[model samples]
Target: MNKKPNVAIVGATGMVGHAFLKVLEERNFPVKDIRLLASGRSKGKKIKFCGNDFKVEELVKGSFKDIDIALFSAGAAISKEFAPLAVKAGAVVVDNSSAFRMDPGVPLVVPEVNPKAIQRHKGIIANPNCSTIQMVVVLKPLHDAARIKRIVVSSYQSASGWGKEAVDQLWAETEQIIKSRIQHPGSSIKVDGVKKVLPAQIAFNVIPQIDVFLPNRYTKEEMKMVNETRKIMEDDSIKITATCVRVGVFISHAEAVNIETEKKLTPEEATEILRHSAGVEVIDDISKEKYPLPIDAAGKDASFVGRIRADESVENGLNLWIVSDNLRKGAALNAVQIAELLIK
Candidate 1:
C-alpha cells in the first residue's frame, strides 16, 4: 500500500458520500488520488474536496481500476453489483450498505468495537448499519466488563438516515405546517402536496417503522440492529431486540438502550468504564440539565452516552442513552476509520 492511497468513492453525490469527503478531509487522510463515482444522473456534477473541485464520474465496470481503496455508500443493489468489480480491480471495498453485512465472509465492522475484524476482509469490509454502529461502540466496552446477556434498544433516528429526499421532505412539511398556522391561527394544520419519502408525515411526528416489515414483524432496520449487534460483539448467544423509529430531527440518531448483564454494574461504574473507552463521551450530569442530545451530537465523531442508571425491575439490568451523528460516526467516519486501519 502506498503512503497515500488512491481512493474512489461510490455514490459520491449522496449524503453519506459527501460525508465521506468531509471526514476524509477533516482527518487529513493520505490520499494520492481520489475518484468520485455516482450513477449516471450525477455524472459531471462538481464537488469540492480539500479546496479542489472534482467532477463526479458515472460508475461503471472499469471505475475501480488503479484505485487502492473504494468507499461504497450506494444502496445494496449497486454494492452487490459493483463491489465485486472493485475487488476484482484490486481495490479493497469498505461498503456502507446492507449488501454484504450479513454475509459471513464479510466482517461487519464498527472500528471502535471490532477493528481486528478488518484484518479478515476478503477484499471487502462491511460497515454495520448506522444505528448498529453507534450502539455497539457504546455497548462493547460494557459488554467486556459485564457480559451483556440481553439488549432492548429503541432508536430515535433522524430524517437523513433515509437520504437527501427525506430531509427535504421534513423541511417542506415543517414549512407547510408553519404557514398553515399563520394563516388559519386555530384550524388543524394539514401538510399537503409534499413528495412523500417517509411512510408518514415526519414534521412534529414520529414513525415507528424504518425499513419494511418482515414476516417476523420487525422492520429490516430493527433486525439489522439485532443481528448486527450480535455479530459485531461476537456473541451469538446474546438476546437482542430493537424498535427503530424515524424522528423529525435532521441529523443525529439517539437510542435508549437497556441491557441485562451477567454481572451487576452500577450507574457510576458504567460511567467510569465508558469514559475511558475509545470513541465514547460521557455527558451525564442530570441536575445541571446535561445529557446526550441529538442536536448537540451533530457533526461530532464521538458516540455520546448519558442517563446511565440501573433498571431496578430486573437483576443486573442497566439503561443508557446514546447519541451520535448518523452520517459521521455511524456511516462515513466509520468507513474512513476502516480505511485507516487498512493502511496501517
Candidate 2:
C-alpha cells in the first residue's frame, strides 16, 4: 500500500479544529503524521491521537516546512498571514475562513456539491461559510435538476460559531437564569431568562445578529452566504438573500430556506432527491413527528433537511428547513474533505 500523507491542522485547539480530528478519525482517512498547531498559550498541550500523545505546536512562519496538506481554521487574519507560506512549502491549504473564499484565483469548495472545483485551486482552497455550506449542499442537486432562480435563507446560528468565548457567554448567561429561577420562582424574568450578554445576552433568547454589520445593514455572515453561494455553485445569476440570527442552542446551525425553482417539484419529489443526495439526509415526516431538530442534529456530520413543502403563493417555489453541526460539515469536515481531495 502507498504511504499515507503527512497532514497538519492549524488551530487544533479551537472548536472547529477539535471537530476536524473527529471527522478525520470517523472517515478513516490515511494520516501518516498529524501535526497539531495552535496558539502560544496552547503549545505543549497534549492531544491524544490513535492512543499516542501529540504535543500542540505554536504556529509560526516556518511551521509548514514538511507538511503535505494544511487544514487552517484559526481565523481569517492568521490564514491571510500563513496560508501562502504553507503553499510555498508545497502544501495544499484548505482554509476555513472568509479570507480567500471570494478570491478569483481560489476555489471555494463543498466536496459534495463541487469537488471538481478543487482541481482549479492555486495551492489554497476555501471552504464556504457554515450557513452557506449546508444550504448549498442541500440545494445544489435540486438546482442542477431544476434551475434555481432565487434563494431566501434565514439562519439560526449557534454561539459556538463565534468560537469558545461566545460559547462561554451563552453557558454563563444560561446558568445565571437557572439560578435566578431557583431563587425567585415568581420573578418576571423567570421563564424569559436573561437577554443581555456582550451587549446582548443569549441565554434563553435569540439575537438577530451573528457578526458585524455591513454598510448595507446586513451582517457579515449574511453577506457571506449571498456571495459565497454564487461563487461555489458557479452560478452568479442565482439571486440570493439571507438573514443570520444567533440562537441559544449549543451546537448545529439551522436554516429556513425558500427557493424559487424554474420548474416545479412536489414535496415528495423534493424529499426523494434530498434523501439520495450526497452528504444530505431528508428527515421530514410530519405524521410521526420525525423531523430534524437542532438537538438531534448536534455532533452529526450530515446536513439534515426537513419541513419540505411547496409555497402556495409562488408559481414554482419550495420551502424547507435544514440543520447541521456547523463546526463539522460547515467548517472542519469540509476543510478535511478538501485535503482528502488533494491526496487523491
Candidate 3:
C-alpha cells in the first residue's frame, strides 16, 4: 500500500472492461501500471486509458506476474480458469462473474453497503450480480432502521446484462422491424422465431425469463437476486421472491421493490434516509412525475430511488423504484471501489 498499484484488466475490450477504465480514470485511481488483456483475437488491439492507448495482450497463465490487482469481467468459465492463477500470483482479484460468488470463503462485496466484507477476502472478492448490487444499495439503509421481513421484487433489466451481442441485436432487430413495416404496410411479420441472442424478439417485447428456469420454477437470474441479496446484506432468513424480465432497454436496470419491515417508516422518512446514504440518490416527487428511470441512471455511479410510498397491506410495507447503470455501479464501478478500499 506504500505506492500506487499495478493493475491488470482481464477482458479489457468488453463493455464492463471499458467501464472499468472510465471509472478508474474518473475516480483518479493511482496506477503504477496497467495491462490490458483479452483473448487471442483481441491481441494487439489498442485501448485508451488515462489519456493513452495500451495494446491488448493475449491473456495467458502467466499474465498475473507482478500484478497488484486484477479486475475480471469475463464470463464464469474464463474466471474459473484464470482467477485462481491471478490469486496465485499474489494479485487480489475482484471478479464480476458468478463463479465464486456463492463460495462461502470468498467475500461478496458492495463497497457502499458492506465494505467490511472486503477485508475478509482470501484473495478473490466476488462482485454481486448487477440487479443485486443496485437493489442492496437502496435496501440496506432502510433495512438498518426497520429490519426487513419479506421482499417482492420485479426487475426490468436491460439487454447489456447479457452481453454486447444482446445490445447490438436489440437495436438491429428494432431497425429491421421498422424497415419491414415500412416496406409492407399492415402486414404481420414472423419475427419471434429469429434472434441472434435471445429466444424471441426483443424489439417491441419483454422476455419473462432472463436465465434458464430452475426446477423450482424460478429463473436463475431471479434466484441470484434472492441469494446474492441475502449474502450481501448478511441476512439469511429474509424472505425474498424475484421475477426477472428482460426489457428492450439498452443500458440501465430498473426494479420495482416492495419491502415488508418489522417497523414502520413514513415515505418522507425513508426518502430522507436514502438521500443521505452513500451511493444513493433520492428523486421521489410523484406530484412532479419525477422518479428514477433507466435513461436517467445510465453512466451514473449512484443508485437512483423514487416511487417511495407505503404499501397499505402490511404494517411496514414500502414500495421503491430503484435504477442504476448495470455496467457501471453494478459491475465495473463496484470493482474499482473495491480496489480503492484495498489501497486505502
Candidate 4:
C-alpha cells in the first residue's frame, strides 16, 4: 500500500477510456506505471498519458498479471467477459458498464454520494450509469436533508455519452444539414449518418429512447437510474422514475429532476444546501439569465445545479436542473476517484 499502484486501463482508446487518462493526469493520481489495453484493432496504437506516449496492447486473459487497478470503460459485453478475469488476477476493477451494476455484491458508486461503499467492494466496483451518476450527486445532499421519497428525472444526454462514434455522427449529420440547406435552398436533410449511432435523427431533434425498451416500457437507461439510484443511496424504498433522451450536443448531460421529500424545503433553502455540497456547483441566477447548461459543464468535474424551485403540484416537492460533463464526473473522474479511495 505504500507504493504507487500499477494501473491498467481497459479500452484505453475509447471516449471514456481516453478521459480516464486525462483525469488521472489532471488529478495527479500516484501511478507506478500505466498499461494501455485495448482490442486487437487498437493494438500497437500509441496513446499519451502523463505527458508521455504509451503503446496500446491487445487485452488478453493474462493482461492483469501484475496490475493493481483496472479501470474498465469498454462496453458491457467486453466488461462482462474481462472484468471477472481482471479480478481473478488480483486487480481491483472499477467497471463502467451495466453488466454488474445491480449485483448485490458490486457496490454501484458515485464518489460524491456513497464513498464509504468503496470499502465493501468484493473485487469490482460498478460505476453507476452516466445519467444516474449526475442525478445522484445532486440528490445526495437534498435527500439527506429532506429525506427524498420519490424522484422523477428527465435527462437530456449528449451524443458523447454513446462514445466517439455518436459524436462523429452528430457533427457529420449537422454538417450535411447545413450544406443541404444552403445548396437546395429551403429543403431539409435527413440525418442518415446519425442513424447508425442512434435509432433516430439526433442532429436537430432529441430521441427519447436510450438503450432498448424493457418489458415495463421504460428504456434500459431509464431503469438504470431507477435501480442505480436506489442501490447507491442504500434505500430501495425510495421511488424513482426516469426518462432519458439523447440530444445532439457533443458533451455534457442535463437533467430536470423533481423530488418529493418528507419535509418541505424552499428554493432558497435548497440552493443554500447545494452550495455547500461536495462536487456540486450552483448557477441559479435568473436575473442574469443564468442556469446550468450542458456546454457550461463540459470538461468540468462538478455537477452544475440550478433552476431550484418548489414543485407546486406536490406539497413537499422541489425541482432542480442538473448538468455535468458526463464523461468526466459521470464516468472517468468517478472511476479514478474510486481508485483514489481504494488506496487510502
Best by lDDT: 1
lDDT tens digits, residues 127-231, model 1? 999999999999999999999999999999999999998998899888987876554434434456667888987888889999899999999999999999999
- lDDT for residue 199 in candidate 2, whole number 0-100: 39
Tens-digit per-residue lDDT, 1-344, candidate 3: 42599999998989899999999999999999999999999999999998899999999999999999999998999999999999999999999999999999999999989999888898899999999999999999999998999999999999999888788778877888788764434443344544577756677778898988999999999999999999999999899999999999999999999999998888988999998999999988888999989998999989999999999988889999999999999899999999999999
The better candidate by lDDT, 1 or 2, is: 1
Query: Can you write out model 2's per-residue Cα lDDT over 171-211, one digit (the tens) per residue?
Result: 87677778766433333232234333343667677789877
* Candidate 2 Cα errors over 4 Å, as ranges: 1-3, 182-199
lDDT of all the models against the reference? Answer: 0.94, 0.87, 0.92, 0.91
Sort all candidates by lDDT, best to worst.
Answer: 1, 3, 4, 2
Candidate 1 has a TM-score of: 0.97
Judging by lDDT, tell me the better candidate of 1 and 3.
1
Q: After superposing candidate 1, which stretches have Cα over 4 Å from the reference?
A: 182-194
- My TM-score estimates for the predictions, one after another, are 0.97, 0.94, 0.96, 0.96
- Give the higher-lDDT candidate: 2 or 4: 4
lDDT for each residue of candidate 4 in 72-180, tens digit (9 for 90 to 100): 9989999999999999999999999889999998888888889988888988999999999988898999989999999999999999999898888888778887776
The stretch of ten residues in a row with the least summed lDDT in candidate 2 is 188-197
Error of 1 at 270 (Å): 0.5
Q: How far is candidate 3 from the true structure (C-alpha RMSD, Å)?
A: 2.3
Question: Model 4, poorest ten-residue lDDT window?
Answer: 182-191
lDDT score, candidate 3, position 123: 89
Would you give me the overall lDDT of model 1?
0.94
Off by over 4 Å in 4: 182-195
